[model samples]
Structures are given as C-alpha cells and as structure tokens.
Target: MRLLAFALLSLWACGCAPALSTFQPAHVADKGHVQAELGLDVSVPTGAIASVVDAGVVLANIAESRELTEGERLTLFEAGGALALNPPSVTPHIGVGYTALDRWELNLRYTGSALRLGTRYQLLKRAKHGVDLTAGAGVGRYVIDLPVGSILGLVELEDFTRWQIDLPIQIGTAGTWYRVWGGPRLMFTTFDTALVVDLPAFTGYPGERELASFSGTGLYVGGQAGVALGYKHVFLGFELTLAEIFSSGELAVLGERAVAVDLDSFIIYPSIGLMLEF
Candidate 1:
C-alpha cells in the first residue's frame, strides 16, 4: 500500500496529468511502448465571461470607428471593466507517452506557453468484457501573455504566470477498432496578471485607469466525454468538456488603485486529436 501511495505521489509530482481529452483507453500500453498525439483545443466562453467577451469585441469595433446599434452600445457599458480583460480562445498541443512499467503510462505534452508531464495507472482491465479504469494527477505552469494594447487600460503586466493542478479518473470500454471514455475531474488553478483598457479619447469618456495586478485562485469541477476510432496503428478522437469554477479568493487587483473583475464562470473546452501508437 505504501509503495502504491508513493507511486501516485511521484506521478503527481511529474505534473503531466490527463486533460479534458483522454484519447487513450484505460488499458496502459505494453511495457516499453510509446505513443504520440497532436490535438487542438478551443475554449468557448459562456455565462458572464461570454457576455464580457461579446461586449469587449463591440468596444473594439467602436474604437475602430465601426458604428454600433444602440443595443450594442448598451451591452458595452453594461459589461463594465470586465470587458477590458481578454482570455485565451484557442490552443494546440502535442503529446508523447511511454509505458515505463506494466500498467503505468507517463505523458509529456506542450501547449503553447505551457508544458505538462503526468502519469496514469491502470487499476482495472477486463479486455474480454471491454471495461477498464485508470486514475491520474497533473500539475502545470503557464506563461499568459495577452497584449494590453490591443484592448482598451490601466493594468500593466510583465511575465504573468498561472499554475494548475488536476486529478482525474477515467473509465471506458474499448473494442478492436474503437474506444469510448468519460470521467470526472477536479482542477485548481491560480494566476496573477494585469489588464489595460483605453476608452476612446475622442469620445471623451474617461476610461478607468487603475494600476493594479489581478490575482486569484479557483477550483473547477467538471467532466469529459470522448470517443475514439482507430485502425491498426492510428486513431482519431474528439472530446467535449464542461467545467464550473468555484473561487477561493476574490479575483481582483490589490491596493487602493484596485480593479475588481469577477473570474468565476462556466467554460467549455472542445478538442480533437490524431494519435499514433507504436
């Protein structure tokens, strides 16, 4: 039991955990086998953040002298300072995995500004019955650099960073040519960054300028559903994930020159991938 616990801890420390898409089956690859994957993930904003993104786009258009209907202008004002903030829309990743020992798979993946290393341990495998189960943990660091100039003004950020840790349990069935899996996950993420918003000088609407940094930590509970189809040595997969964040700290800038932007929101990540096994 102690050895198992130690192994799990070491895996978590490795920092590459399965993400929203676990294209692999719960069955670990044969010992010494290797797998390679390439995928794309797109984040679709929903709830409050979605509203802010829409309003921000409108504000950007107005800055470029694009006229808006009265309703659109209303939305821009309604979104408030939150509109000034921009989040990532799309990211792509490449992953490689190796089975160092029987029933254990270690993974390494790179997605833009982030790199992750993780491991999965197969707990149950019933090939005849087409059932399998596995669990894993992951930790990762990200450098988030979104140019403040493109958006409208008073937060200045240099080398903003985010940290994330997640735990996931996957269960699924696999046949000779296909696999299906879905499972639950818990993710904790934290970040520190600044924002820049500039109201048009021509409009003379004094854009709020507050020189402050934003920092917050939040927990997300979510699940993923995925399907994979493959030939002898290759597979194609797709996954859709939904998660709602519960915050531990208020997402805001510090000090008297403070800006408060709510970071609590619901989000969706959809991904597609091609995998090759050897």
Candidate 2:
C-alpha cells in the first residue's frame, strides 16, 4: 500500500495545471457589450511529467512486483492502473466577458470543478497599424476527486480530494477580431485523504492507523498564443499554452509513517472555442 501512497501523491503533484480558459481580447469590448464562449481543452504532459507517463507500463509492473512481457505491461498500463494519472485527458470549459466601462472588462470562466474570475484593462488600444496592449489578473480554484479501491478486506480505501488555487497575470495584444496573450501564473495545492488500515491484522501492530492529509505549493510561469476568426457577432478560435513548475514546497503525508513525495513539473495544452458577442 506504500506504492498506493506514492501513486496518489504523484498524481496530485503532477496534476496541478489549472483548467483551461479561452484567449481573451486585449481591448475591452464595447461598453454594454457581452461575449460568451464554450470550449474543450486537452492537457498534454511535458518534461518530467511526460517521462513518467510515458513509462507507465514499467511503473505498473514495478509497483505490482510482477514479471510481465513487454506486451503485457503495455496492455496493463493502457487498461488504467497507474496510467489513470495521465491519459484520456479532456475537459469542457465556459467563459463570459462583459464590458463595464470604456476600457474595463470583467470576466468569468469555469472548467471541470474549477471556477475563475478576472478583470482586464486595455493599456493601449490598437491603432491603424499598431498592436493593442492590455494587462489583466485572474484568480481560480479547483477541486478534484480520485477514488482508490478496497484493500485487504479489513479496511476500505476511499477517494482523495484535491483543492488548488491559481493566480495569473497576463499581458499582450488585441486586434479587431483576434488576440494573443501570455504571462505568469502561480498555484497552491492541498489534498485530504482518509486511509484506514488494520495494522494488527497485517503488520502485527496494535490497532487501526490512518493517514488524514497532505499538501504542497508551487510557483509556475507560462505563456499563451491564440487567434480568433469570425464575422459579425460569432467567432471561432484555438489557443496553445505551455507552463512549468519552477519551484515547489515538499509534499507532506501524515500517517503511521510519512511518505516521500516527488512530482513532475510541466504542463501544456491546446483549446478551441466558439464565441458570440453582442
């Protein structure tokens, strides 16, 4: 079950990217105007995260301490054991932006179990041949639940709940119907888990032992590029973003004995959406 703890912590540490948001316009919308959008995002692992996910088959075999043929290991990993931490990655998101005053914009976005609120100020409007400049900040929070199965018949394994916060600063350009933006982002994450094990039954120890919680925080920096195309009030666009966890606090697990935590540090994604403005 120590392997189980390692797997779960790895999942939490690697899964820190905030759910995706669509690219925003550099210039605020016309006063009294509103824009609504719906999209799908796909997260692609990079750096250490990518390496670990790519070696899922080997990791699964190692955790189970089983002898597996190459084909068997590949099949097992694809069937969703340790691979559960990586694939089938897609989520839906929705966002809205409202123009409050001449150069001020208010926005809200939602993806999975996460929500975000933000504001943007147009620092420089686009001229006949000049790009627009804007700066904005946003805050987001996410909650995720992962279920681990029953163990030993003496106790049942429960779900792990992950909570996270994201703060981002964006600076970029806006065009009549297209925009490109990039910036820095910060994140904090914590998790709660209830692990009940009958120590006397297995380890010859006294009674039941439980591990209640774990947490970690990190700083990440990333950038994004996107373009929109449309006519009148309807538009379509795609965006690509890349981010890396540059530094992180250690993950601490509380139980009979604490477990060590090591996490991968990179995330990348692409998103596409449709928007209607009025």
Candidate 3:
C-alpha cells in the first residue's frame, strides 16, 4: 500500500489563458482508487500577446518610414509576420481522479478550450519523511468564437465567453517512485465580448463599420512547480506555472458611452503528463 503517486498539476489561468493542467498537491487516489491522465499543455504569452507582437515590430518600422508601394512594403512585412511570429499555444490534456471519502478527491479536466471539475482535500497527511497538503476548488468554461474573416477576411472575434474560478494550494512530497510538488493558485475570471472591426487599407480610413463591446474581470495569481516519476502503474509529470494577469473592463460601442479598461498581463504555463493508476 504505497501508492500516493502525487501528480495533480491541474492549474489554470484566464485572460490570455489556461493552466494546461499539471498538478501535484499532496496525494489522493487511495480509497476506491482511480486515476488517469494524459497531457500536453503549453501557453506562453508575455502579456497582451507580447504586445501584439510588439505592434508587429512597430509596423515594420512604419514600413521603413513612409513612402510606400512594393505592394505596400509587402503588406507591411506580411502583417509583421502575422503579429511577430505568434506561437506557443498548444493544448491537449485529460484527467480523471476519484477517491470518495477518506481524504476526499474528485477531479475531471480537459483543455481544448476549457472544461474543468474539481475537488481535493487532504490537508496534511504524510509521515515518515513527511510533508503533504492539498486544497482545491474549480469551475470553468472558456470559449472564443471567431469566424467571418477573422483577420485576413477582416477582423472578427465576435463573442467570447469566459467564466472561471479556481483556488488551489498544494505542498508535497511522496515516495515509492518519486513525486514533488509546489503550489499557490487563484483565478477568478469573467468575460463577454463582441467585435467586428474592418479598416485596413493601410489605415486610409473610410472602411467604416466598427462595432465593439467588451465586459471583463480577471484576477490570476499563480505559482506551481512539479515533478514525478513512475513505477507501480505508470507515471510521468512535469509542471511549471507563473502568472499575473489582472484585468478590468467595460468598453462599449454601437452608440458609445462605456469605457474603462485596464489590462495587465503575464503568463507562462507548461505541463506534461502521463499517468495511470487503478
């Protein structure tokens, strides 16, 4: 009976998003056991999509300071390499855990857009080279709907929905293969959106029609660390998370009056997993 293979990196973030799930916070999966996992989640955006790729490298330095034509300077260096080489957003993760009584544990996760269910409580329990603690709470739903020329077709990101709440705390140590953890996570998010902007004849105005609406609230403060190894059933885990994304908003249009937005950002999440326990 040496199977507390801690691996609960089920972290999350919203406001440029995702925890990508790679959690380890003290053990669970003993009483009536059941654990399953699969993962790969990565999100790296150093704030506002890296300032929109540094404003596309400052519009390729303003198309090399005025005087265009060369197909508009190759469409401004291909829209500044599509916003400065945008990359680092990968998702795919799955999780399942159940403990039922005796320390309680229940979790379900997914990371395509978002889907989560959580429960954990094992508040310190590990002796013999001890250290264990766990805490949890979760709720999620994040979706971004964009269609109708989303960028080349001409700007659209109509309707975005986000509703999340998570509070996690974990501290760890485990053996019989190996496991280590770290924690501190808190996320509370809310969102609403609508946008359809068109105007890009090299900003020569007159491409009218601009509608905007945004409603937001976000707070994410994070910390996570992880490690895991395998043996009696298969395990492998790795996690790292760092966060800061404070947001506030109210921006309206379509007959104006409603403005206030203060968006702050920072994020770096990484996860990797492979687990099975029965």
Q: Pick the candidate with the highest lDDT.
A: 3
All-Cα superposition RMSD per candidate: 10.7, 8.0, 15.4
Global fold similarity of model 3 (TM-score): 0.33
lDDT tens per residue, model 2, 112-224: 65677888777776663266666676666554543224332222334544444555445566545655556554555444334433223223333434333323444555766
Model 1 misplaced stretches (Cα beyond 4 Å): 1-19, 58-88, 128-130, 143-149, 152-157, 203-210, 248-254, 257-261
Clashing pairs in 3: 8-23, 8-24, 9-22, 9-23, 9-24, 10-23, 12-19
Clashing pairs in 2: none
- How much lDDT does each candidate structure score? 0.60, 0.53, 0.61
Best-fitting candidate, scored by TM-score: 1
TM-scores for every predicted model: 0.75, 0.66, 0.33
Question: What's the CA error at residue 265 for candidate 1, in Å?
Answer: 2.2
Per-residue lDDT of 1-278 in model 3, one digit per residue for the tens?
A: 11111011012122224553546547776888877788777666566645544443444445433544444333432332222122235567787879998778888887666678888888787874378887888887755432122432333455566778888888887777877888876888777656554444444433344566666677878787888798776779888888776777665556474456554667787788887777
**Sliding window of 10 residues with minimal summed lDDT for model 2:** 76-85
Q: How good is model 2 by TM-score?
A: 0.66
- Displacement of the residue 139 alpha carbon in candidate 3, Å: 10
Among all windows of 10 consecutive residues in model 3, the one with the lowest summed lDDT is: 1-10
lDDT of 2 at 141: 58
